[model samples]
Target: MNAASLLHLLQFASPALPIGGYSYSQGLEAAIEEGLVTDADSARAWIVCYLDEVVARWDAPVLWRLMSAFAAHDAGTIAQWGGCFLASRDTAELRAESVQMGYSLSRLIAELGVADTRALGEDVTLPLAFACAVDGLAIPHEEALLAMVFAWVENQVLVCVKSVPLGQVAGQRLLLSLRPEIERAVELARRLPDDELSNWAPGLSMLSMRHEVQHGRLYRS
Candidate 1:
């Protein structure tokens, strides 16, 4: 945990990292449209459940495995995990969001003269590509997982602030409430076996599918 490695992890998780993360609400926008997340309380509640069920249960664990594979330099493992990760996305938009972000991050990594992970193929999903960057920095897996969880929480909070039309204070409050959950999420992901990880957000999938056809949408699903 030298200062330089810490800085690299922060920069890797920076919202300005240019992965187009702000563009996708991951179905929050559709939920807002349907009045499922009308106010600050509801918005906060929705995101809390989403963090525990969708992110902690699926994305973080997938990311954990990806980080493990990257650390071992196991390209086959990375590719296999990428397939499973995409399969977990219940909707087409969700799948595209992961792939597009993954591609953008991969190019950014190459541009930074990070390890030439170009051999990981054209479609290295976000978590895998992100793990490649974090592993390159020599950040430990646990620290990297925390960074991923924080970044996701921050991004989804912004999604709520914009879509739910909540004030900045409410969004900040929501983030504060979720801070302790990041450690819990990291712990949950660690204890999760690879065979047990699966995506199971039917409500989110329906919202995302609806978002594909929703009119006057402010964000992509």
Candidate 2:
């Protein structure tokens, strides 16, 4: 990637991008409450599964499709994959999180003259909005996917640290261990077809639903 593209990716992936990622754990907090992720090891395991089963298999591939569609200026494909992304969310909380992040990023991009989400309507999924921004910024597909996964890894690790009460080192350790996996996930995501995109995470889905009703909550999803 060129320096300009690299800088755009960095800014888009930064934790301070203000897309409200820190507000949701995507069921991590509920897992902690249920004693499923009590320490660093358990937290790491859960993150790996989520990254592989949920994120890599579903979002990353969808993101790849969205990036391609955006590059081609195919609005129909963009909307199709965007709907697929939102529909894959198992619970209301999960769906809302994606929508909210999508709206935020899309609005920001529009305001900055990057991409016009108005034509795409308001209920954009995060993957599409993010992909649109990268496409608008002329970021390469591979780098954009890496940036997206890296952002997710960073956000989820911080979630574990705050919700599971893991140490800073533990969080950093999890990030380190997931680095190779992230790259592999991006590569696999690139190769995946629309039919191969799966959202099979019953455990995560159950946790997400349980979290919506759980008394003590630390996250939005």
Candidate 3:
């Protein structure tokens, strides 16, 4: 990647990007409420499991395919995979979270003249929108995927720190420990074939579904 693409990649992956990632736990808040994650140790386990199971096996592969589609300007393939990703959301809140953030980033890309999101149509999954931005910014796929997973790790750690009331230092420790797993997840995503892609996280799915009715929640999913 050139300096410009590298800078754009960093900007896209930064937590400061206004996509409302801080507002959602992606099921972690519910897990914490249910006592599944209570400390830095448990939080680390929860996040690692998510990375190994869902993100490596499902999200990254879908993101890879979407990026390829965007690079090829294959609109039909983009829609196909985007719909699959949206449908894979295990709960209404999860689905809505994807769509809401997707819309936010989509609009941001359009307004900034970064990408033509109109071709993505009315409904956009986060991965699809991100893929669009990566194409527009001329970011290399490998590095973009790495930043994407790392950004997710950072956001999940933030969620744990806030909701579990863990210290910021503990959160930082969690991020440090998760580096290898993040890299491994991205590597797995790179080689994962389409037939083998799966999002079979019943535990997470159940927690997300129950989160919809949780009495008082800090996150949308």
The residue pairs in collision within model 2 are none
Model 3 residue 67 lDDT score:
94
Per-candidate Cα RMSD to the true structure, in Å, reads 1.1, 1.1, 0.9
Evaluate residue 28 in candidate 1 and report its C-alpha lDDT on the 0 to 100 scale.
Answer: 86
In what order do the candidates fall by lDDT, top score first?
A: 3, 2, 1
Candidate 1 structure quality by residue, lDDT tens digits, 1-221: 88988898889889988999989888888988999998878877887788889788889998998888888888898888888887777788988999999999988988888767767776678997898898777887888899888988888889888877878998898888887788898899888987777668888889999999999987877
TM-score of each: 0.96, 0.97, 0.98
What's model 2's overall lDDT? Answer: 0.86
- lDDT per model, in order? 0.85, 0.86, 0.92
Show pairs that collide, candidate 3.
27-221
Which regions in candidate 1 have their CA more than 4 angstroms from the true location? none
Candidates 2 and 3: which is better by lDDT? 3
| Per-residue lDDT of model 3, residues 1-221, tens digit only | 79999999999998898988888999999999999999889999999999999999999999999999989989899989999999898788888899999999999999999988888887788999999999999999999999999999999999998999799898898899998999999999999988999999998989989898998887888
Q: Which residue ranges in model 2 land beyond 4 Å of their true spot?
A: none
lDDT of prediction 1: 0.85
CA shift of 2, model 3, Å: 1.7
Local error of candidate 3 at residue 221 (angstroms): 1.4
**Ranking of predictions according to TM-score:** 3, 2, 1
